[model samples]
Target: MSPPMIIAGIVVWFTAGSLLSWHARKNLGEGMIEYFLADRKVGGFISAMTYSATTYSAFMMVGLVGLTYSSGIGSLGFEMTYLAATVILMVIFAPRYWAAGRIFRLVTPSELLARRYRSPMAGAVSAVLCLVMLVPYASVQLMGIGYLLEVLSGGAIPFTVGMLIAAGVSFVFSWWAGLRSVALTDALQAVVMLVASLLLLGFITLALFPGGLPEALGSRQDLLKVSWTFPMFLGLTLPWAFFAVTNPQVVQRLYIPSSVKNLRKMILGFSAFGFVYTVLCVVFGLAAAVKIPGLEKADNAMAMLLSSVPSPLALVVSLSITAAAVSTMNSIILTLSSMFGRDVVRTFLPDISERTELGICRLLIPVITVVCFFFARMQLGLIAVLSSMASGGLLMQLPTILGAFFWKKATAAGAVSSMIAGGLAVSFMYVQGLKPLGHWPPVWGILVSGTVFIAVSLATRPPIDTEDFFSSLEGYIRDSFGS
Candidate 1:
């Protein structure tokens, strides 16, 4: 991976992404909905791909492998659990969400909260938490881009420079095209990532492991099994089970379906795709661990494995890695900006025109780009740590969001308190050096927050107009079904 080749590969990716952005802006009409949600026009296939790409992000490439390297086989639980959770969301939540967004013309998940709960304050809270969680999560993607560049270029490009270039291009593409641009680019990137994954897997298996992956695995069988004791399993799975329900990025995906039929198709398709992709990633990590033993940390597994391959092959893998980061970063930046402009600013300054709102969203790209660049330079090992930390805090939103759409008895106060208590408890544990008795803090956070939410909602007065929430959502379902 010479400097010129590395630069050229990136230049090609950004150029293609830019072209797609231009096309999106031209066709999608620069409205906030178009920018953020692709005007709810995405069909089954693209939606599934977008969901998988966003969910996988750079973490699967870098962090999953790193985990497989350090923890052995237990990391497979992450993907298996994610697959289970996603399937449930598709079955129970996606159809309803698409309907809700279609009826309300939601630009952000917070806007959905506002409409459902009929409280500007609730919308504001949702918006704040989304922005807070997403920016850092997006930044983690940028950090992966930096890392990919650093590894491929053999340290010729500084990590900061690499992150800036990658995030800068992502921010620009997202700002220009909005949802259309992100979707189109994501579709293309997803293909690239798929090819890259398969090719790299083959290369590593045949080229590196002469006896093949199964043989290599025999030596490190311990790394391939589930590491979770019963308690650990509960801590990890329970919180993550709630994550797909509440995660803004994950739930925001529910808003993009063109029809209910399409939503069903995506659920099945994405569940299969996500399961395969995650399983392959874990396998790659485990194989890498076998090839490159004694890893001090899990996150470095991918990079360490790449170092063993030929430079040119490593470069291809690196490009796929870049695609992983860029694809997710673009989506996150677009979502965060939309949330900021629509959920936070538009509340107090409703007079701000839609055109102005779009402009504000575009302006935020650069601001977020800089922040992500700074974090990319930090010693943020693998992206999984950053993702887990953010996901843990935001996991508190799960029960409340579910209650809003499904539980009629859920009150606004209870929803608000649940989010506050859950988010705070997770943050507190992190700050206080609290660890989940050999598990993650998010596990406890989920339990504590979830219990409070259920108790409070049950104990409190019912929402003033629970029927309004369902009534508003009916139009969406009808429209989706009809369409």
Candidate 2:
């Protein structure tokens, strides 16, 4: 494919996305609530699209595809498990998060923890942990765009150039009108991601494999077997299983829908989109494995396969990958900034004006982008591992989250201690490349964090408002039932 063809595809996509961003800005409401949460008035369909787009990122096409190519059906099982876990968790917890956000007038999920525990340190610790751990996952999106463009263009576009282009676009979309622009662009990009994936799959079926997938996979039946070791599968799937509750970017989405009706629609719509997209991406990897076998780097399977397709079709598919990466990165930047402002900074000042807080969040967008840009430039390990690593480190939050909602004696000391201890455990293991006793770092992290949370909570006093908080949730449930 010529550089000009790929360039033209991205230019057109960029133009349309920019127009959407500007249009979203026109209707953007004032203040922090409007900027970060769309004033909690987003419609069902848009809510669904934004949630889907944010959750399924460049990871699907690039990282997950590559994992499937190399690891076979086990990768599919891992992702499917994640999908199932996410939906189940959302069903049980989304309403609670939505109610808490409205009841507490919270701007971020971390704030909910603060309100629940009546300890600013609990929220501040959670927020800081997110800011640190989420960077690796965020950088994976930039790395996806970098690898796709660089491989497809045969080095006509350097990886760094691709990373910068993605980062710039993400920053712009998020900066324009906060969540309004981000969500609107996300809705457009989500459609492109789904439609383009379906087209690519159909093309591969008809053009690449005339007979059917089974017929095409004649000699690679072994690829369908679950070859991954028990430890490897457990290490990867554990954090992702709790992703809906742990990952801030997705957790924040629970607060966006206009009403309980819209929230249900959001959950159902995301479930449908997620299942289809996950299948498409996994199949794509399997197809690439059969078409272009034994690529040294599995991450390049999608790129190498694209290079063999028609130039025009390749350009469209490549643009879809770009859209996935940009939409996800921008959402992370937006969500993280909100945490920094509402949870971390406000913890100290306690009296900062809303205008200043919003301004701070907007200002941090590029700064965060630049930091992730540099990290992406490092050419990290396999995309799937890096992404899972981020989630694993974030898995430390699971204990704190559970305690906040379910445990009466869960104290701020327990929350802060468990997070700090669990987070450090994961970080040290990743840095040293250590996996003690065949389990991954997050496996160890959950153990340490959960134990510490229990011991410390039992030892310390519960928050004063624990009863009130629990009662509020029960009251909301009663009111909902009555309505």
Candidate 3:
């Protein structure tokens, strides 16, 4: 690991990304839809790649690997459960989102909710919650690349500098062509990420095991067994299981594919990509547990393994991890900027011109990136907890999202109350280190929020247009998907 290698990696990554961004810009139009949603004309391959890249962040290599290394088979189970749940959720929700987007020309998930709930206030509140919960989650991506660069460069490139590089790259591509650029580069990065993971696994297997993957994994049989309690597993899996709806970035992706056919491809392709990546990460984690034992911090397992590898391969793997972070960060920034422009700004300024809205969103890209970069520089240990808190915090939105699609009785007050109460409950519990009744924060948050949502909705009047909205939506979905 050397400064030159780190510099070279960054150079290569940015150069490739710039070329893709240039290509993306060639067909890009000057409109909010063009920039943010690729004019809803992206094909299947790019759509799937972008979805996969955005969904599986640096968390896969760094966080999931560490979790698997420390916890064993439970990590696999947890992640697989998330993947399965996501596919099922997508099967049900993707068509609905696509139909709504097409029918209303909606630009953001908040817009969909607002239109359904008949409340600008609902959309605004959801946008604000996304900003609050997702900024820290986005910063975690920056922090991850920063930490990896520092470790791989042997501290020649400081963590702050790495954060700057990540933030700068994210801002440039996101600002250049928006989702078009982001998705194209994400497709490239996703390929690189998968290839890099496979290469690393091969090298590690040959170097450490010498026999085969089975031998290596079998030697650590005990480490491969389930070690997590049911409560612990449930707590962690709950947020991720609902990630397709809870996380705004990925949820917004539901609106990007060109058609129902492309949307179907996106789901299936992402499912395949997720399956391979998860297996690579889990195997790597088990390998690390066997080969690089006794790490004080589980987070260091990937770094340690990389340090043990030959310099060149380690550099490649490091760049792959950096790619993961950049792809995710750029997507998050673009999605958040869209939320701000469409959900927040338009709520207050309903008559704003499309040009002004797009301009505001483009300007906010760098602003949001810089905010996340500064948060990364703080280097808070609680950052990891905040990452988990984001998923749990977002889980509070599930009832509202589901109710919007299915339950006609769900009121604006219920949506707002559930999100606010659930977000507060989850955040407070995480901060105070409280787990009510010995359950995880997410479990408590979901229970309390769901209860509040139901009670508040039953006690109050539903939206005036609830029936019309559902009836129209159902008709649109049926016509669009022919189901």
Per-residue lDDT over 170-215 for candidate 1, one digit per residue giving the tens place of the 0 to 100 score = 8777777677777788877887788888888778777887887888
Superposition error at 189 for model 3 (Å): 0.7
Instruction: List TM-scores for all candidates, in order.
Output: 0.92, 0.97, 0.98
How high a TM-score does candidate 3 get? 0.98
The CA root-mean-square deviation of candidate 2, after full C-alpha superposition on the true structure, stands at 1.6
Ranked by TM-score, the better of candidates 2 and 3 is 3
Better of 1 and 3 by lDDT: 3
The C-alpha local distance difference test score for the whole of candidate 3 amounts to 0.90
* lDDT for each residue of candidate 2 in 393-483, tens digit (9 for 90 to 100): 8899999999888889899999999999999888878877899998989899899999999999899998888999999987885676343
Residue 244's lDDT in candidate 2: 97
Sort the predicted structures by lDDT, highest score first: 3, 2, 1
